[model samples]
Target chain A: MQAGKPILYSYFRSSCSWRVRIALALKSIDYEMVTVNLIKDGGQQFSEEFQALNPMKQVPALKIDGITIGQSLAIIEYLEETRPTPRLLPQDPKKRAHVRMISDLIASGIQPLQNLSVLKQVGQEKQLSWAQQVISSGFNALERILQSTAGKYCVGDEVSMADLCLVPQVANADRYKVDLTPYPTISRINKSLLTLEAFQVSHPCRQPDTPPELRA
Target chain B: MQAGKPILYSYFRSSCSWRVRIALALKSIDYEMVTVNLIKDGGQQFSEEFQALNPMKQVPALKIDGITIGQSLAIIEYLEETRPTPRLLPQDPKKRAHVRMISDLIASGIQPLQNLSVLKQVGQEKQLSWAQQVISSGFNALERILQSTAGKYCVGDEVSMADLCLVPQVANADRYKVDLTPYPTISRINKSLLTLEAFQVSHPCRQPDTPPELRA
Candidate 1:
């Protein structure tokens, strides 16, 4: 929406960042990627400079339309509002709510509980299991809800904002070794999403800053 | 927007439920509050019936406009979209993003990390202190962000969805023994918001399910 390309402060392996990356790509908006190393020296995101950019000290903060905004969904909604093409939200109010529901199920319900900050608090010994429990419970509910709402994507065949939230979170679940077989719908949807160029380019491993060993 | 009065499946002490309650009151949309206890008998929210209603087994699932929507912010957005009168979001795209940003900060950034499930996972001995850290860090960031945005409420004088989210979170911070004196902006905003009838009527203490001893 601004004259120059938007700048996204993101990390290579951050699911939240990947969510916004996919949204930007889906909208075909040009963006400059500014990597925030979340794992280096106890996180560059905590630095005073980045903190000034995002008082929350988190990534996927976008400098677009002359103001910086944090929270991936909020940024996505902003893009949808300011530059709405290949719309990510459905027109019907109820369908729009369903898409938002699926997104929130991942954003608020699952991701934060298993976030790196929370996992560090859980200690290395309990991190995987803690992530597993949160992800599985969320996926179980998502699968049940998606069964009623999904066609090909999370909300019908159209790729909506729900798909943007779903793919990155599914990647995080994979990283934590959460079993996906139980959630056939989620697993299937994720598999289909990965085949798309937008999601492919936005994959964590394909990022410029991804560790060589972790790169796909 | 629906023919009959909407039904909100909520709990007295649930911050998420309180968010929806405040939005409902602010919109002047009449709704029936159906209490779903989150603490009794190991949380009635985990019951088979309640789980069917909300697969996530969380409070603040609203049945309105002939469909049920979960997640407080999603519910509020739905209300804003379907009922445009007395708007909860500013019309400017950037300002709307700012309102959503504040709401997201409280919802995804703070609430989930300190949720009852997360607290239980932290263990009894660590729960309060853990909540304190999570909420304080969040509020500290929130205070900084609000300095530029807040006036009468979060995101200016309009009393947007951000205020609906903020008031309940401040209540939770008090419950966890977080000292609010450090966040003068948040404290001031919360104080001003409480003076409004919508926020007052929807307060946790004023809910029908509030215990006799807890009622104001």
Candidate 2:
């Protein structure tokens, strides 16, 4: 990154941002952190400057070597591609598909349903418990898939892209009071992953921009 | 396809299932459509047999060449990897990541929030308008993304995985009465994509498995 380190526009509690953070750290790529508080004065992400960076006005947008990118799964894949030294995806096509599948399972299926914005919407018009129930069902489904597919990580023994996606969502789920017992495999994988330096350094609680109220 | 074509466990109205169907048709790979009704008898997708194939018990599960894969994004990607003749993803990593980002924006970001399950949760407990608002806001964000990035297709000229994801989700947004006028780019892209043989043939209304009552 001769042009300079990638700049990540992120918020501490944003699971999507956390996924990208883990990926950058895993690849050992140097990058500057640009905090975008999601809850301050109607979201810093919606600021004109940030919106230009990500028109979607969401966290986890990256400006890498002058090019800006968004979406956690895509950002992680980009890192895996550009920094191929310590690979985050398997080389085999089938294995790569499996890895992508696990990542999508979380990125597409589970995480979105329980995102902060969605829950805020639920709380406004629907009941908080109702949103939690919807989130729990998503988690239950995730746990079931992880049971057969996971081994130390989301896909297999390797620390693939799936694990990066999995850990943060699991962290968010626990905060919502989700029971981890039903998803033993997911819980086990989370346990193994939390021990790693990549995940440890990327924890939301450690972020400089995390809200004081939510800090553990 | 030696085992009498792959069995696609799908729901006619499912956007996720529709994605895989389009991919299958694009490749000219034949598949047996096995309807798993999402609304009948508390969702047939939750049945023991279906759960055996997909622990998540969601439609658009593919039983391909002896192996079953769940999640539409995963299934389409698996096909892309396994059969590379007509590539769905670009060769360049940055471009591939761009395609995946657009796809992920729909798959993970937009589609999940407005799923039938989510709406059902809202209807079962909350007001109808509440659900519509959630769907509308998500679509609005999507429209913003489409406005800047989309060309004749989602990511410039080619028909890629993002197009497959875009059409189906747009269909769902229409079902919820979300207006298309605000999203001119999305509407324009949808119009062009609709003309394609793959999208036309794979349309839910054109599907043989679609119940007469649900046919548009």
Candidate 3:
């Protein structure tokens, strides 16, 4: 096992990186954060050193167990395996699948569509509308799914990987100015989740790298 | 277990649906295909009946064990759990995590950005370039990751979940004309994967619902 404290190569504003940061805090894994400014120097994540850690050149690459793991969900899975305390996924097969379904809906279905890279590609004129449409479509599904699966959280009372992924994507949705009025369950869950210390401290604004003006 | 063949609610052209189709074939699980015709009836997936099966209103929702599972990867995971004979994920934790990393890079990183809904929203003009850029960026990392993780397949010779996720994504890349020459390993692996009968049968062109003219 890697002896040193785990290091997270991340940026404050990246929703993908935020998912990892929340997960690390949820699992209570102490790790050092090395910010990779996604905007500065045409993206610090493109640097050779960072690329070596994560060839994807994406942030939230965790250095642990003498190995570097990229992909926020993948890193969270590794952490879950190594540190099972306060589990991030449900034990039941169906519930676990349910949790993953919601997580994937956000991670793959929502987040990628409205990501900064995508927004930039769409340009300023259409970016907001484009992102809102994507997030709105996803939130519609999320609200319906939560009708049966949710109870104080995305999936029943306990926090699963779904919650970790949920809060960040919702945060992004807010940034994209997507109306949450149509998604009562999602808004309720987001409100409840943000009240917790784990979710509180991991918010993008509270991160060490968050810009002063953006800080809450 | 519920009797009869499992039902796959899918559309032939969906790359995400193709992933599950390949996985079901790989595991030798008999599943009946119910074509959803993503292009017709203003997209049948958005219909209330379809939404009941999958709140996300996405294709490749599987009906098995008396429960409908949405999300292609989540469906695959459920299938992996119910039928473990032909393992889709690696046995080792690290290797499994590695396999999942590549899967997410495609599933979450690339696929969603170029999804049909997103494409329609981006408008006809910029769609092709938008998709190509996203695929190109993802392929750059996939190529690098495969350098170490690949050996005859995406993870040391065995056809893990990574390959299943890869083949379909690469298919989308080809459709968008992403220019595969820059990524040798991805092309090589895609070539190897396509050679398998399971992959062949699960191909979009070979699906039951594929238009006759589009059939391979």
Candidate 4:
């Protein structure tokens, strides 16, 4: 916990949490991580205390100097604005929109479909299949966009907000055993992103609170 | 389609389609809307012709001059960039983030759960229930944000991209029969948004390809 920084209520294995973590690290912002063991005892997200922090009952609810902000993408953007030294977004409007489009593609198009809560609703076998289908579908789109847009990172050579969004979701895709053979651009970007110390430190396995079963 | 504008492969009832329609209208950019009936002939989005436009086989694919762009959010941002008039996002970075947070709340957070395709995967009753649940959950979060942020629109009165995103999703929430009694702020903002000509022109009911069954 860094003094005067915000408080993040996050679960180690949560992709949403990982997104915020990567963003914070990329911006070199410091904050306290409050582990809300999401899978423990029927999910901590549903607990009354955590629920108060985020009515949506989701991971990665940030409380900064008494103001609580939910949603991973939102939180990252907030950080980007409040701390703009290592810019996560492009200064150019068109470029920013491109970054946002990629971010939304992952956040809306891919992540929700493979979310653990949604997957649990599908049967175990079907869940795996569903995860693969959604990931492949979303990654194929990402691959195409990357072919023209991806530089050293998702949008360009710079480590922008899009990279913050992509790395964790790509990690989730790997967890489901989805084959990336169809999306070489995405696979290459994923490989490139992993080398970043910011991304490396934010991996779920490295988080202090990640459960043993999910620490792949 | 405008003389030099893109060709949009859209379906009448797809929220994704509605999103792009509103963006085109907001930017005052003209485009040809080619109706690909999502439900007819086992969904036109899955047709080989549409597949050629979008390998992912999704509605709201755009043929810009020649290049194709899939995903509603991406397509909308592309238009905002390529057009760049009547700016869809706020100029201030923090305010823009706030706008996108709200947009994502609808675009990523709510729409996916209530989409026709996702609903089709589950049966009717479950579909209705999931639709209601996701809408209520999303709307509640939105209401809270609106209370803090709204002046005349979602992000401090200016008609930003957030309003464009919200109006259509709120329409879907109403279609799903999600009770709006609990979301007074969202209900109020939505009512305000409906008064806008841009929203009115893009409404699903007003579309030429809208099926009789879905019309109000």
Docking class of 4: acceptable
Q: What local lDDT score does residue A116 receive in model 4, on the 0 to 100 scale? A: 75
Could you give the CAPRI-style class of model 1? high
Q: List the candidate numbers ranked by DockQ, top first.
A: 1, 3, 2, 4
Candidate 1 lDDT by residue in tens digits, A1-216: 557978999998999999999999988998899999998989999999999999999998999989999999999999999888999999999999999999998999999888888899899998899999999999989999999999999999999999999999988988999988899999899999999999999999899999999988
Q: At residue B44, what lDDT does model 2 achieve?
A: 93
lDDT of 1 by residue, B1-216 (tens): 468889999999999999989888888898788999888899999999988888999989999878889999999999999988789999998889999999999999999998988888789999999999999999999999999998888897888999999999999999999999999999999999999999989999999999999999
Q: Chain A in model 2: its TM-score?
A: 0.93
**Model 3, A14-67: lDDT tens per residue?**
888888888888888888989999999998988998888798878878888777
> Which candidate leads the pack in TM-score?
1
RMSD of each: 1.3, 2.4, 1.6, 3.3
Each model's TM-score for chain A is: 0.98, 0.93, 0.97, 0.94
Question: For each candidate, what TM-score against the reference?
Answer: 0.98, 0.93, 0.96, 0.87
Once fitted onto the true fold, the runs of candidate 1 whose alpha carbons sit more than 4 angstroms away are: A1-3, B1-3
Q: List iRMS for all predictions.
A: 0.6, 1.9, 1.1, 3.1
Badly placed stretches (over 4 Å) of model 3 are B1-4
lDDT of each: 0.92, 0.81, 0.87, 0.80
Native-to-model Cα distance after best TM-score fit, residue B141 in candidate 1, in Å: 0.7
Per model, the share of native interface contacts recovered reads 0.82, 0.71, 0.79, 0.47
lDDT of 4 by residue, A58-94 (tens): 8888876456777888788778777887988898765
Off by over 4 Å in 2: A124-128, A211-216, B1-4, B124-132, B213-216
Task: Give the lDDT of residue A50 in candidate 2.
Answer: 85
In model 1 chain B, the worst 10-residue window by lDDT is B1-10
